[model samples]
Target chain A: MKDSSVAQRTVFFISDRTGITAETLGLSLISQFEGIPFIHVTLPFVDSAEKARETTQRINQAYQQDGAQPLVFATIVDPEIRSLLEKCDGFYIDFFKTFIPGLENELKMASANVMGRIHGVGDSNVYNTRIEAVNYALNYDDGARTNGYDTADVILVGVSRCGKTPTSLYLAMQFGIRAANYPITEEDLHSTQLPKALRPYQHKLFGLTIDPKRLHAIRSSRRPNSQYAQLAQCENEVKTVEAMFHQENIPYLSSTNLSIEELATKLMVISGIERRLR
Target chain B: MKDSSVAQRTVFFISDRTGITAETLGLSLISQFEGIPFIHVTLPFVDSAEKARETTQRINQAYQQDGAQPLVFATIVDPEIRSLLEKCDGFYIDFFKTFIPGLENELKMASANVMGRIHGVGDSNVYNTRIEAVNYALNYDDGARTNGYDTADVILVGVSRCGKTPTSLYLAMQFGIRAANYPITEEDLHSTQLPKALRPYQHKLFGLTIDPKRLHAIRSSRRPNSQYAQLAQCENEVKTVEAMFHQENIPYLSSTNLSIEELATKLMVISGIERRLR
Candidate 1:
């Protein structure tokens, strides 16, 4: 019989991906409702209808016991499961329903877009381990005399300042891939060959090539407008790097307009690393 | 179909908090299953039964569509809501159900151990913030001339090597609180008074008093068996520090037998910071 207006609401986030992504995203969304006091619960990685049903019953009992209704925010990817949740006695917000329509519309607009099963590379652990290995390789310094090319999980050969460090670190931190990068110096480029130690790990090698303009912009951030950061020189260097990758048949991804996530995802998808995790 | 061995399971973590706690704990549990390839999803912050139903339906749909059954691992505090989740289409594991029995048994064993619901601590954020604040205060190092005593979130005025730095850093890193510590030098001991700057923030302050033997062991890790790390001296220092805290009416927790997490959790609960987040 207290003021009805002051009643506190409870909220839950249900997802299939350890609920970390849902929780992270939900935290931002909840921040929008600053003043309302709400209780939050997270149910993560629920992968079955039986578990879902049990969770729903529990929610129903909580409502009956507390004499208050609660709200649920869910990101369930399966459709039949969504119907099971619909029978519950409380209010619910489904994220997939909200997002799917938009995704479908985008797919329609791009008629030629590829539709294929997204092969997951392995569990988070395998992906994380590989990323870590790559990072360890890239950060190896050998007293400025020799390239620390031996330690790379995947030694990426490219021209100077071609989106190596950040990409490597992102892969390592997010996915745990050990990435190493070695710049194809002028001598190596003149010979048109990868460094000697890289030969043994050629099967694990990848390359990144970017437009000189993009490279110049990226380089300019660290050292503004220097000769080393010149656009024309960058373009020339990129052309040489591309030719080398093409000649050596070292697969490369363009860094021109790709986000780090997109680049990593694409590389992971194409590199046959996705299926090797199991 | 291939031999009907156990199909891979999907695990769910449901929580009233951000699900971070459940996820962290669940991850540790799942890590025990070395060869199993299971999917993990999180449904965070489910506040009500209606929402739980919607989420349950989604789980059913996933079962129907993907043919992947799920297992739920949850930490739902509200009983009625727990029943709702139990009805879902999966095997379920609830942490509260698992822990409550033990807790009840403990209560029955020790009636004197009962502590009343101190105050309504809102959530974990306030607890974390206070811990961080205390840590930041302790770690603030000013130039050799003057002490950085004014900047502490909670100036822990305790004798030398009295479990200050480790506790402070743990609070700050885990909770993002700005913690600072000030040593109770011999001059302060002679005067037998808390620092002047700590007066205004007394409510926010916390004290950690440990047994002298425990304090000596902790100190010996840094400088082995030195006079500064002596058990007798440590015992005397602890005695003096406890007397000062008691004289000033400042509440404190013992660090003698508590793990860092347990210590921090107790401090958060006792200091009334947990209620602020809710």
Candidate 2:
């Protein structure tokens, strides 16, 4: 059912480089307004005054056509280009203008006016640490490198498709944590014992289990009409894994209904692993 | 010489769940100012009104102590709790207040006022795609699954430690791309030929080469006093990789002075890979 009461306003995210920052902040700001529908337009690579002028024209046209003022969220680094954008006929929120003068006053110096450096890329060493963590996560994935267990900060154990790999990788990418994952296969579940390789790293163990229905859905998509994807098999595996976690006194978390980012954060809180990024 | 004129202010990122949205938006806003040094405090899990009062008290205390109005960037969803925190003495930028009422008027509907959904986790299917892509990237890393190249949307080729794996993983995690990366060895570089395994996937191949100096520094850290870490070897490998890329007419980008995010964006532009996220 269409909500005829909702007002649809045009919103622009203009940036000199990829408009990720502008869009992230702009969308977040707009998300607060729940009842209104926003039509988003991202004008990336808007470094030149010509592009700014064109964007200004588009903003004005949207305002004219919509019979409402459009909202402009811009982070243009160039002063001349930002000034050009400021002339647009809309409710302008120049993120750059709002904060730069205050910062300049505090520092008593001019900013380099670099484009796309915020969350873009800065400090090769920090960048390398993140990349190295990713590489470590990749190499240590799925019990591929049992010998590297001592170096791992955390080792996730769960059934196939329980999201060990993604959670491990996210921990690595976002937190610079060296995470390794080991899949709990059918044999391990039947045996009701932690794998010998994992026993040594028990202190580092964190378990993930998904709801049987969600597990079945995920597995059936990959291997349909097979026993591995059977709902019965999923239910059995999850029950067994949860039992094993209880029997072995290992802490665990349900992978169901949790985003990888959220799962990572929860794991960090539980395991006391600090985030790599400040 | 230290800048004595610089001002330092306490900045708060308050949210009911993980403070990612508030922190990301707050940091980007703070990044615009050059000379001010920010002391960041992230107070998450403030879901209760009592906690909100405590937070307000803390904010007021910080303002009094610092003798400068602290910057309070918040995303508290509860109206009463937000109203409570708004009583604090500080430079408050209530993200919820700036847009919610206008949104309420436009949509003519009430927001769920849910906590932790923004940037925390949502949509099981989309989340699964990212997990599936990460698994795919891990499986195909370093020519491990060249047979799976047919399924890959992009294949990255580069000398060892030139950042093929991390770039591929980032693409998968952030964009839900089925990315595979293959390492170009000295043999492949010296022979000046793309490996037979890669020839069939020529259209998908993208090369990465790092600056020899930076590569030397990275390699030396990993394997000190080794032939691989020698500056001469680093120079030779980069030269060979660049030549092979030019001769083979493969699209390429430098892995130097670029963050994984930037590299991913440039690769998307060059290969025309659409981002899965809106």
Q: Report the CAPRI category for model 1.
A: incorrect
Tens digits of per-residue lDDT for model 1, B14-42: 76444544554455344434444567766
Model 1 quality (TM-score): 0.38
> Taking the candidates in order, what DockQ does each have?
0.02, 0.39
Error of 2 at B160 (Å): 1.8
Tell me the deviation in Å of residue B219 in model 1: 20
Candidate 1 residue A65 Cα shift, in angstroms, is: 32
Quality of candidate 2 docking, DockQ:
0.39
Q: How well does candidate 1 score on lDDT at residue A88?
A: 78
What class would a CAPRI assessor give candidate 2's docking?
Answer: acceptable
lDDT of 2 by residue, B79-143 (tens): 88888888888677766666566655544566667666556556667776787788888789888
Query: Which structure among the candidates has the greatest DockQ?
Result: 2
